[model samples]
Target: MRISPAYLKSGILVSTAGVFGSAFLWLLSFKAMAFWMGPEGVGLFSQLRQMAQAATVGATFGGTNSVVQGLAERKDEATRRQFRATAARLVCLSGFAVVLVIAAAAPLLTQFFLASSAPALVATVRWIALAVLLNVGGTYALAVLNGYRSYPYLALAQIAGPAALVMLLGGAGWWHLPPDPQLLSGAFVLCFGVTCLVGAFGVSRLPKLERALRLGALPKAQSRAFVRFAFSNLVAALSTTVALLLVRSWVIEAKGLAFAGLFDAGWTLTFNYTTLFLTACSAIYLPRLTAAVRPEDRRACMLKTAYLVLGAGILVCHAMVLLKEPLIHLLYSSQFQASGEVLMVLVIAVIFRGVSWVYGTLILATRNSRILVVSDVALNLMLLASTRYALDSFGSLQALSWAFVLPNFLYLVFVVEYACLQNRLMCRRDIWPFLLAGTSPLFYLALSGPQWANSGLVTGLSMVVGLGAAGAALLAYKKVVS
Candidate 1:
């Protein structure tokens, strides 16, 4: 099916706005929090969030994403509504239970993460935990909207939480209150509560969802299939989280919380900016891929999405790598400026991850959580191993960054092989565009120092080249399509 101009434009604009808006607000909150709280507090804030999110992913039982995949292919509106509502109901029950567990564990986890648990830290953990529970409905709402291909509403709900949180933080800043982790956590919870309310309202307004409230019992077979898929996905999600928590633990043990904060800061910057493209891809591609049942159709969609995102990622990463130091300094204090080398290396990861998301979405759309688990577990193990060696030997985060790059390369190789062989998708003509786009930033970075990259003349030249290459990749993709 050809993408209509208005539909495509609306999708891009709204989805981009959604991602860009949320990123902006979150980034802004980071800046404000940093200024309000010192680096250590920021570190605590970030750590709490990571832990809370991991827990939420587990507690979700993978219902959020499975809702999308389950509903995507359902041509029956009533059935889709049932699936959506069922997931929402089940996740809410799980969320409440998870909140209780997190609340109980807050004291211990706080001490574990921070080396000493104070009342404030424990309180902060509780607040973030509550936020996670509070936001479950919103999470499922976005998933439902996505399943329906309601990009605009999905985008709206995506930003609603962050936007609300930003306003709260901004108001706090206006009042000149000191930004403690607990206070920031409260803002997170409160704003997210609002976000959940907004999402529920939005979903309530949808046509058939109201009918879901009227339905009594779901089809046993359908419910069984969705729950099974969601459970498998939950394992994958939780496993990745465990791996990440291990990595964070290692970083803190080796370097301390201050450095952990810096590491997270660097990592966060890379993903936040780069994920903008990935977000757009998900909004546009997942439903499309989900609706395509034929193997050829799925493969074709995967390659096209991969090439498009990878091509776009090249230009973005180039600009980001070139501007890394300045961008970090602009967003954060001088304390964060140490991560330039790491960010430079992470540029490659960004490009790789940009494409990986396409492949990942394809895998997810096909409901192959087993592949997702194996690939992810392997990469995480490699990451944990290499990162351990790098930290032990070189004692440098930059070395650790390269360690991540190694596993990710292997991960992408495995992913590409799987996507090609399993789906029988062949796009030899499209491969070069991704390779060229993915490699150009790395080539430039390896040859020049960060100072050279950041210089006015070099930055300008690189931007020009990047824009040209990205534009050409898009043109080439268009040609392939025709």
Candidate 2:
């Protein structure tokens, strides 16, 4: 089977648009939360979200990637059905277990995380647990859709969840809902449930999925493979989650809740928007990488993906650094204006993250779970350690962005070396794009510094030249990939 560039382009556009919609909707919801709840309120909500994410990752039993890889590689319907059956049973059982654990520990969780064990807070935590349950199922459905390369349906399900949240948030105004943590957590549960239902409906509409759902028992061998993958994936996912949580908690403890809120505003912008580039290519790239048997073919897929991601990421990150002040005002509030500095440095980290995503996808696609697990854990650990050091040395939350930059840059080096040594994926031609893309953000940083930031003529000229450079690179990359 041939990989058409047009097909790749269409899939990327649709998937990116869907993710953009979700990001935009969340931005709207966040703007309301910022207005009503203020910076400290946003901080508390961010903590709750981190907790939900951790629970959701655990609930899935690390089966998300396994399901995607399994279905993508399996050719026979019967085999795919068996594997899907195994994944379903594993995720369902694990999701239930996670809910139980969270419910049982809610009071303790509230005391620890929120620094109080109030009954109302426990209830709020329990609501988040429910969201985790729903989100787990939703994530599983998404993995299946991704495995089958169902881009359009996958896009729809992605948008529906966030759209539901926006609608619920809007309804809250009409319903006179309290802007407490409970209401926010409940909205999370409702939106996740909606996403799950939409995704399941899409799964049902698949030609083979209905029969697959009905016919197979959970095979022991497949279950073990899924479990193994789950463990590895869980470690990586939990590491990243817990690392961020710890960092946020540390910031809250050190600088206070209001400061953490500002940091989170910048983090939200950096993480959400940068992920749009990854989401754009992931749906199509993973399945294609899994299906390609020859090393040459895999290498080609990796190069094309890296170029597309880097090309787009460089441009977007550049614009973000340039317009971060206004963008922050637009997405958040004037109160969050201080986060502009954070956003400026964070975009460099975002660029590094984009580079890592490209290579990381290849690592995951090849099912080199140990490498993935180790690199992820190490990177997160570096992030935590470096963050503490940076905070102490610089004594500013804006300096937090530096913690991620070096670790991600190191991770980029680690993965590129692995790709070359273990799989021979990189060539001489691939070197320049990575170098150019990686350094592009630095140029933006330089231009945005105190020395040149005030010069409108310089900034305007830089924007023109930067965008032109991006377009030329895209054209050149198109020629190479084609």
Candidate 3:
């Protein structure tokens, strides 16, 4: 079940294009929305969107990951088809339940979730319910694609849906359509629904879908196993959602809407950038790891990915730090300059996050979900407590910014220990390469002054130095590994 280099390369390209392109388009749309509707409007939009995303995680109920794992374990086409069908059925039912909850909570969400100043923001919360339903549909289709290893089509759908929404929203904004949160959210719902419809069509082409959809097709025993697997993931997903909501709600309550907007924008930038690389890496690596025959091969692959992603994270962090002032000024209005420092702190979190993610994916592939669930719960609780204290003690937004780093660092340490205990992986040796490669970027950032300088010149130099150092380290690592 090893993936060919050609398939891996194509997957990398498609996944990167999908992640980065969608991120770019969505950021542009948000920028446009900010310009037309103001920071508070964007803040309201962001809050509701986050809530919808968090809710959608519950609706998905871990069915997405279960599908991939189930497909990998199944040898017979009939079994695989049955797994898909059962999973899809559960997804639909769970999504309906979520929709009902959203509808029931809409009034409270409108009044309390939104900032009091923006009374008109209630409509956007309602629209998010529709968007959540569409999102669940899209996730189910994506799960099917992942099960089939249809990476290219999955990536295209990911890019297309968001791209369409951004374009539509930007065009409407340009035409001076009355810019409101509800209007913007409605546009999102429309785009998501269309995307889901398109994806459903693509998924229908797989013969397994028809096979799986037959009534009473799978054995009762297998059906129960599928439910068990999905249920574990559902619990993990729900816990993760609660963790995110706790952090986000704290930011809104403690700081203010304006600070939340800044934090959201900065966090989005850092997360999206890291996701661009990680998504591609995960897409190619996860299935391979799951199907890996030898412990040596699995450890080797995981170590390589960890080093590469860690280096990339460092390079991105340094670049963001170096160009923070100018990039913030250019991409967003002056108000967002406050996001510069926040982005810098977030960049640090991203570095640790990259390491944690690589090992975390390995754990999942190994079917060690219990350990992961425990680790994640602990990390999230620590994050919540620390962030609350930081927010209370420090008057600035750095409280939330700083809170993320410690838990991620702790997770990285735990992951290294777990891998060593489980696989006899040489964490001490493997980690040094990543640490050495990561330092060059930090050094570059430290040496680079924080003064507002010529935006173009500084940014160009930062790009050159950061990329050059990262590229050299990667080449050196390849030579050593080879």
Candidate 3 local lDDT, 134-162, one digit each (tens): 98898788767766777777777777787
Candidate 2 structure, TM-score to reference: 0.91
* Residue lDDT tens for model 1, 1-482: 24477987788688778878878877877776666664665566667666766777777875356777777777776777677667877887888888888888888877776666779878888878878887776677777776666777777777888887777776776788865677877887876687678767777777654433576446888788878788878877677677777777777766787787787777778865676547555766777888787877776677667667776777777877777777888877777887677787787777777766777776788788688677777777888899889888998878878877778777777777677667655644456455665576566764587567667787677677777777776766676541
Q: What digit string (tens of lDDT, one per residue) describes model 2 on residues 1-482?
A: 24477976787777778777777877777776776677887788788888888888777755367778888888767677788877888789989999999999999887677666677878999999889999999999998887766678888988898888878777775566666778888889988998899999889877564433566664677677767777888888789888887888778767776888898898888875566546656677778887877888877777777666666766776677668778888878899988877776777777768767877877777777798799999999999999999888886755787777789888878877777875765664565555564456455654366667545666566566557656765665676642
What TM-score quantifies how close candidate 1 is to the native fold? Answer: 0.91
Q: Which candidate model has the greater TM-score, 1 or 2?
A: 2
Error of 1 at 96 (Å): 1.8
Backbone clashes in model 1, listed as residue pairs:
none
Per-prediction TM-score: 0.91, 0.91, 0.89
Q: Give the local distance difference test score of model 1.
A: 0.73
State candidate 3's TM-score.
0.89
Please list all clashing residue pairs in model 2, or write none if there are none.
Answer: none
Using TM-score, give the best candidate's number: 2
Q: Please rank every candidate by lDDT, starting with the best.
A: 2, 1, 3
